[model samples]
Target chain A: MKKVYINSIGSISAQKTFENASFLETIADYNDTVLPAIDPVYKDYIPPAAARRMAKGIKMGVVASKIALAEANLENVDAVITGTGMGCVVDSEKFVSAIIDNNEEYLTPTSFIQSTHNTVGGQIALGLGCNGYNFTYVHASISFESALLDAKMQLETEEAENILVGGVDELGAHTVKIHRLINHIKPEAVTSKTVLNSKTSGAVFSEGANFFVLSNLRAAQTYAELLDVKMFNTLEIRTLSKAVLTFLQVNGLFISDVDLIILGNNGDVAYDTYYHELTDKVFAETPQATYKQLSGEFHTASSFGLWMASKIMKSQSVPEAAQLNTIQTSEVNTILLYNQYRGENHSLTLLRHVEV
Target chain B: MSELREELKEKIIEQLNLEDVAVADIADDDSLFGDGLGLDSIDALELIVMLDKDYGIKLSDPKEGRKIFESIGVMADYIAEHRTK
Candidate 1:
């Protein structure tokens, strides 16, 4: 019944995105198996006592949400929805190791309390003193898309005006070690300049927090209009284009209508072809961009993709850092973001420039 | 007794991640929580584990910890009297 606008945005990724002025002007390039986000000063946003107990993921979520709220010029919101794949892995690892190290004796509850997937949403609600609907989605790579869909439904139905939605994941030492053992992370470090060409079996893993303020009412802060969002748990490479076409058609669009297509190509030789196929044939003429080289690969890394798309729509400029193809459109309007993790959890998110 | 108080202060600083507050900043009689060092319920639980694991002094009730952890002076005295390890 109502149009949904991305009123405010916040991002804390491998690059310095927490500050709104810069949009991938300088990318934080890392050549590591597991990358961590360049952090903002936690003390300025959170009190010392509260921050001390917060794991990396929670702090990122809280700070990113605050930035979104501040940018929207709002004190509180109607709902807070968050998504995470690993869900506070730093604290989960601590709690599990503490249990084993102490022989299940004299264990404290702090890490255990913070280890849940919904803790970020709960903590944000507590911080804002907003006890409205709080939800968290943990659907692997499509986690962020799921949260966005939930918020979009409410906003479109006019059930809620302003909703805070975010996606966050923190890298854990033990988790990285296990993924490395399983070859989920690339064998060699891949730099941003050479990530897509690495021909690697695994990806360079990373973590980030990206948030958005969604409302039915558009204001000067509106970044873009959230046209549509869809997620698929399993997708074959051959059927990928068909799915994209159907999604676009349902949204009253066609392949030629898309101005830019943001892909999630993380240099994994086995699964990247799913995205490559789309670029090679179906959406070849569309200007393309990729972000995993800058954000690294995580379950919720697609939120970083959404953040980039929103920035492009609002600023009306596509940074050279995110360019995937040499083809640039004269007038960029509609952006199609497609992401999948390890050949599963495929997500399609469409964002368009808010028509003035 | 003064040595024990200083040791308690250092332990509190390290355990609670009080990076801005140093040992010398906390006086012996200063309260450990609520308008003093500003510790909360979570910090109290951390101190309880410290008592059991570090000093072999276990208090089954967390309410008892309120009295024992009132100040650095009180905490040091309790540990000195009850420590078994």
Candidate 2:
């Protein structure tokens, strides 16, 4: 089987992640119910004509892919895979609202065309003129992980040399309001420093796009070897630890061998306990870290967590802002990332530092 | 004629969410795409809808928009000749 490595990564999140020099140096502490990405100059990456009709999610995904490709020094990839939970929600809301408000008369096609879940992947392929393979997954929280797994499988099977895989979510006003109605968003805005300790039922909702250029060939800029990625559609809290152990075992790793563990604790009082189960029990000694506090909670926000893991592996330093526990490792080599949403769609990713 | 062109620019800005651009920034004969205003395929779709909704000119294919939306001058001319509403 061929090996897989992350050649490059790009993220546009609530924090200033697009400019490579900054690493959450100053975060937008939100007190509102929904947080939007700290957008880059879209015109700098996307042409005006092509960007005219793109929804926020599509813009982020396409711009992020461009940044990742530019970093990888490639113009096109063999495949484009994307994950979006709500899937072009800004357009979806626009179309649906138009249908209702206009009473189904003279409705335009722009929103309908942009509302498709695969539009981002399609637009990326259109932009790059790459027609090899395109796929989009909309499986709620695990959508991004599903895209990652698909890209990894293709790389391992030698079906594609380089693939662009990404996850994106955009906040819609109506969607945010409805989620707040159900307590899926925090009752009030919480700062990044206070998100985990908010002790709220809902999370601090946010949006972002994280993209990676994954290839079978390792290079100088490669972040880490994607040892293995696994996802579960439904995993109970009791089964979570065992499932993680099995995932590590398949990768020939033990709980103690993990130099760092990144958890997706999104400040949901109801579901943060899932992380507590492992952090307090099975992997107490492993240095624990989390990113949702910095990035905010979205269905595909775990993609940002993966980006953070890749950065930590390459830099061999974990940002003090992300540290979840005091346990420190002298040499950072192996990193494990665990994420789930509202107690479902759990994922565990194992990454190993390359010697070169 | 000039009012129609100005209206078109405002409609385009509003419909396409050109949040940073203003109607005054657009010249009547300036290109709607590429160098002039940097509109793209997505913007073309928005213009297509404007043609249909406001002027009652329905374009089945997006390619039809390339000529009609070349500029505010061309768009207003096409809409003047083709508008049913």
Candidate 3:
């Protein structure tokens, strides 16, 4: 089996972390219930002719992937895989609303064409003229992790050497309104300092795109070695502890071996307890960190968390803003990322510092 | 003819969600795609529906739309010639 390494990563989130030089230097500090990504000047990466038809999610994904490829020093990849929970939702909402408001008349096809879940992956392929394998996953929160697992499997089996994999979600006004109605978004704005203690049932919703180039060969610019990735469709709260231990055991590691543990605590009182369970029980002694408060909560927000983890392992520095516990490690090496959404679709990713 | 062209520009902006661009920015003779207004395949579809809904010109194939939607002037002329409504 071939070893998989994250060669490069690009992310556009609520925080200013898209550029390689910056690492959450200045946070957005949103007090609103719904937060949107700090968009990059996409024209710098995508030509207006090609970008005119792209939905916000597709544009972000494509631009981020371009940035990742540029950083990896590669023009094309063997495969492109993407994950999006509410895929091309701005277009979807537009199409659906037009159908309703116009009584099915004067309904344009652009919105409908861009509304597909696989549009981002297809667009990436079109942009690169890459006819290799392309896939998109839309299984809610685990969507991005599933894409990563697929890419890892392909790399391990030697099916493809370099793959572009990413996760993206764009906030739509209508979707936000409905989610707010259902109490999925916070009722009021909460500052980053107070998000964890909001004690609310929902999270501060946000959206972003995180793209990475994974290759079987380690290079000088490689971020980290992707040791293992696992996802669970359903994990009972009681069995979660045992599950984590078994996962680590299979990976030939223990609780103490993990230098830093990244947790996805979105400040939802209902789901934050899951993080507490592991933080208080299994990983109490490990240096802990979380990023949702910085990036806000989205279906694919865990991708941002993984991006942060890769940065920490590569730079050996955990931003003070992401610290969840004071147990500091002398040197950052092995890091484990755990994330879930609404008490379901849990994922565990292990990455190790690769010395070039 | 000028009114029809202006109306077409409005429909295109509203349909394509060109929220950043205004109707006045679209010159009648300027290209609707590529360098002029920066439309693409998705915008072609939106214009196709406009042709069908507002002008009663049903073009089943998108390939046929390329020649018809070259510019706002071309679009208005095509609708004026074939519009059943």
Q: In model 3, which residue pairs have backbone atoms overlapping below 3 Å? A: A31-A189
Q: Can you write out model 1's per-residue Cα lDDT over A115-222, one digit (the tens) per residue?
A: 999999988998999989999999999999999999999999998999999999999999999999999999997788898899879999989999999999999878
Which runs in model 2 stand beyond 4 Å of their true positions? B1-5, B17-21, B25-85
Tens-digit lDDT track of model 3 for A215-326: 9999999999999999999999999989999999999999999999999999999988989999999899999999999989988999999899989988889999999989
- Backbone atom clashes (below 3 Å) for every candidate: 0, 6, 1
Any residue pairs clashing in model 2, and if so which? A31-A189, A48-B38, A49-B38, A49-B39, A49-B40, A50-B40
Best by DockQ: 1
TM-score of every candidate: 0.98, 0.90, 0.92
When candidate 1 is compared with the true two-chain complex, its DockQ is 0.65
Model 2 chain A: worst 10 consecutive residues (lDDT sum): A20-29
Better candidate by DockQ, 2 or 3: 3
**Residue pairs clashing, model 1:** none
CAPRI category for model 1: medium
lDDT by residue for model 1 (B1-85), tens: 9988888899989877787899989999999899999998888998999899889999988799999999999998899999999
